[model samples]
Target: MVDQAELELFRDNVRRFLEEEAQPHYEQWEKDGIVPKSFYRKMGENGLLCVDQPEEYGGIGAPFEFSVVVLEEAARMGFMALASNLSVHSDIAAPYILHLGSEEQKQFYLPRMASGECIGAIGMTEPGAGSDLQGIRSRADADGQGGYVVNGGKTFITNGQNAGVVVAAIKTDPAAGAKGTTLFLLDTDQDGFSRGRNLEKIGQHAADTSELFFKDMKVGADKVLGRLGGGFGHLIDELPRERLVLAAMAVAHARGALERTVAYVQERKAFGQSIASFQNTRFTLARLKSDIEVHQAYVNECSGKYQRGEMDVPTAAMIKYATTELEGRVVDQCLQLFGGYGYMSEYPISRDFVDARIQRIYGGTSEIMLEVIARSVLGR
Candidate 1:
């Protein structure tokens, strides 16, 4: 179970941090299409980069719930781009190193990541592949000197433009299908590695999503993460936690949008009376409130399971699908209550509407989630 008091303290800290550091400059960051690297360094200084990392790595090594607290608080502020960037680093990339990296790799990377000195990203999605890991076209061929020459391109990579290190998935054997897949710890400074323009996105405007190109990039044999053929298994093992993070963010986002809408309806007038006084508005809000509360309970339950190391892939998939869809519905409904104001970009609801669109797409799409759930249920 999550420590309520400790979680509250963490939430307060994140809220103040955002208010003082992030909220004021969010508009500029959105305009720039990326947050400044200095902002991540500041978060690192505050011990916010990876709260669950081991103490030696500069993290508090807190429970996963604490990480969830950070995600929730950040999402509530409409900072999904920033939140997503952090998630890709801490929630997605850190696990690969912590679970499979050698002592040398961990010693060199973990502390920097914990301190936000190096931004991290993962390259799994490609122009032709999203969730189908076997469809990856990137290849890393042995160079006969205990190294590999990597070649291929990836698209829709979060944090691609600013990443110092990337945990990239590639095919070591074209005929081995999923068994042939491998992962590598790639350095952006290496020759033949380059990033394309920061791809314009409809939502999460401040996040640096881009296309990554690797042309004959050379990687030391020591840079391979995990067993040569174990990338698929490693990804499967870590996916539940990733989905849990997304689900927690979705629940928190729904609550934030609902809260903002309630405050707006109570103040905005229509037909010579406050919108809140209307039966339709009240009913709509009541339904949404109930839904959000229910989803929050599920998210909390999943967090508990995650803390205990008992969370399963299917359950995580369920939560991710349900909560994200709920977030989408809640934001749309809340926007409706805003009338013309909702359509205005200056309004929080408009931003929320745009940001919530990708929840169903990334972190495993809704279709993929259903496929996993069905396999578990139908004994497929």
Candidate 2:
């Protein structure tokens, strides 16, 4: 267990860093379609990226809670783009390399990743496939020279524009179904790898989501992550933690939304009184606040299970599915209270409303999560 005071200090430090660095430039970054790479470097300098990684690889190896705090703090401040992008870099991508990569892969990647000298990404979603891993069509064929040539495309990839390293999933044997899947470590500097435009989104605009292509990209067999034909299992194995990370963010972000809405209602006037004095406004605030606090406890419990290695896929999915859906409702209701101003892009509630949307769709859709949960209860 981490010392409580030290964790509070860490949270304070993270908030100070984001206020000074990210908060000021976030609007410009949103307009630019991406956050600058220098900001990532600064995050690294402050030991804000991958806090759970080990010291030998440039991390403080702080407890998992520390990483959760970093993400939650960012989300609580309404910097969804920063929170979303950093979640990919620190929570999703870095862990794949840490847990599955070869010694050489770790040495070459984790240090730079920890230092924000290199950014990491995962390539999984294809044009045709969103939630189903078995539907992936990108492929890698053995070259008979102790290597393979990869050819495929990935869309909606987070951190795509600035990725120094990508953990790409491709089919080694398409006929074999999920059993044939393989994961390759793709170094973006390689000749055949190309990046498409930074795709625009409804929100989280500072995140550099993009479409990536690989054409005859040859890599040594050594680039294989975990083992040949292990991609699906590897992806599944990681989902619990991945979903947990998103769930945590959802809870924190919703809290932020509620915070904004409460302040807005208290100050904004209605029929000769503050909007918050209205019974309808009071009830809505009460309900949302109650829901968020209850959900926070649930998320905290799930996170503890994860830290103890006791969390299962279904339980993780439950938290993710529940909290993200709650986030959607919370933000939308909060926006409703803002009246026409909620529709404007200028208000933080508007951002919260839009940003809350993708939480359900990504990290496995609510439907997919339900199916996973169903399998546990109904027998697959």
Candidate 3:
């Protein structure tokens, strides 16, 4: 279990880091449609990235709670772009290397990733496949040199545009179905690797998501992560962490949005009185606050279980689905409370609304989460 003192320290460190490093440039990055690579390097310098990675890899090797702190603080500042981006690199991508990469691969990549010298991304979603990992059509043919020639495209890849390396999923034997799926550490600078335009998203406008194409992209056998034909197993193993991280972000986001709305209602006047004086406003805020507290407690409990390696896929999926959907609803209600100003881009709630939209879609969709939960309940 995470102690209050440690959690407090982590909260302080992340809050300071954001105030000093991230917040100052957030708006400009949003306008530019991407954050600079230097920003990520700065985070590494501050030991802000990959807190849970091993100490040998230049990581702090802190518990999962540290990561939760970072995500919560980032979300509180309305920097979901930064939170989501780092979650992909540190929480999602790094584990693949740590658990599956060879010793040489770890030594070569882990330090660079820890120091933000190399930005990492995972390519699992294809144009034809979103939650259906089994439907990916990217192929990798044996090159007879113990390597493979990769060819296909991936879309909606987080960190796609700026990623120095991508853990790409491809089928080495089409007849093998999910068993044929393999993972490769494809260098973005490789000859046949290319990225499409940075997707203009409805929310999280500052995040750098894009389409990736690999046309005859050559990757070494050494770059293959984990055992051949075991890609599905590896993904399944790590998905609990991924889903937990998403749940943490969701709870934090709803809390932050609700807090902002409360402050607004207390100060903003309506009908010759503070909006907070209205029974409607009082009931709405009361309900949101209670809901947020309930979710926060649940998520915190899950975070503890996750640190102890006791969390399961079904529980993670449940929280991820519930919290993200709650975040979307809370943010929308908060925006409505903001009246006309909420619709204006000048209000942080406007961006918060946009940024919160993708939470239910990514990190496994709400529908997918429900399926996982139902299967568990039904003893499947």
Candidate 4:
């Protein structure tokens, strides 16, 4: 459960932080293609980095709702790229350590991560694999020194360039398929670990997305995450929460675009009249608002389920697919309301539109989400 008053207070703080610290510099970062690593440390100082980990690790250890508030505020401010980076560190990577890491691993990394001194990245997708985790070609064979020598590369890795540590997925036995998959936490400064240049994209320029290569990178056996051959299971266990937050982000993004469009339509004139006075404009925005409200409620329900530990794979897939698809549609419709200005890079809607595109691709593709949903309905 969440305290409504506290949540609102936190939302105010997050919004103020962004307006003062982030928004003014966001466009510049977009041009730079990466947020400064020092900015992350600043976020730690503000206690805005990771809000939900245990206090011993320098986190507030607040309820998951506090994190939800952070996510919503980020998206509301149109800071999607930065929000995604923080979520990856706080929600995605840290949980693996909290749940599966040895005491030494937890002690060494969690505090640094919580303080934003060490950014975290997860390596699961390879050149040949995206949704199909079982198809990854990265390999890790045992070294007689009680460690594994990792070989192969990961592409489209979020936070790759800036991450101090990475939880890499590798195949311990290629012939064993998904059962052969293993995860190892490696310090990126280690010998033979390299990062490729930041990949250019249509959007999300501020977020560091890159290709990571491991050339016989050595990781001690103690660095293995979870049980041997249980990497797939660990990933599966975490997918629902990941997908759920993505859904929430989608809804928040759409709401941001829609709100901006609402204000734009009222002020922008067309054919000697305000566009808001036109029937078509009213109907378009009305439909979009209605759709957003309905979807927002569903996402809230899903979030509640997640906090209760009742979120399931199929439901998570459904929300991910539905909300992301809805985000695309809502943003497109909202952008259309801006007419030519929407197409201009100067307009915030343009960024929102492009950023929404990747929501469907990562986390899980729309097609993959459908497959997961269909399996639940048709019996897998």
Winner of 3 and 4 under lDDT = 3
List lDDT for all candidates, in order.
0.90, 0.92, 0.89, 0.88
* Order of the predicted models by lDDT, top scorer first: 2, 1, 3, 4
Candidate 4, 1-380: lDDT as tens digits: 77889988998998898888898999998898888898888888888766888888888988777876777777867888887887788778888888889888999999899888999988888878998887899998989888899999999988988999998888998999879998889799999899999999888888899999999888889889888988899999989878888888888889999899999999999899998999989999899888889989998888789889999999999999999999999889888989999999999999999988999999889999999999999998
* Model 4 error, position 309 (Å): 1.1
CA lDDT, candidate 3, residue 362: 91
Q: For model 2, give the 10-residue run with minimal summed lDDT.
A: 298-307
TM-score of every model versus the real structure: 0.98, 0.98, 0.98, 0.98
The sequence of per-residue lDDT tens digits that candidate 2 reaches over residues 1-380 is 66889989999999898899988898999999898999999999989998999998888999888999989998988988888889999998999989998889899999999899999998999999888778899999999998999998999999999999899899999988988999888999998999999998999998899999999999899889987999999998888888998998998999999999999999999789999999999999999999999999998888789889999999989999999999999999999999999999999999999888999998899999999999999998
Ten consecutive residues with minimal summed lDDT in candidate 4?
Answer: 68-77
What CA RMSD would candidate 4 show? 1.0
Q: Candidate 4: what lDDT?
A: 0.88
Model 2's alpha-carbon lDDT is 0.92
RMSD of each: 0.9, 0.9, 1.1, 1.0
What digit string (tens of lDDT, one per residue) describes model 3 on residues 1-380? 55789879879988998999888899998887788899989989989888888999878888888867888899878999988889888888888898888999999888899899999999999989998988999999999988889999999998998899898888988899889998889989889999999999888867899999999988888988998888888888888899889888988988889888988999999889998899988999888889999999999898888878888989989999999999998999999999999999989999999999999999799999999999999988
Q: Which pairs of residues clash in candidate 1, taking residues 3 or more apart in a chain or in different chains?
A: none
Clashing pairs in 4: none
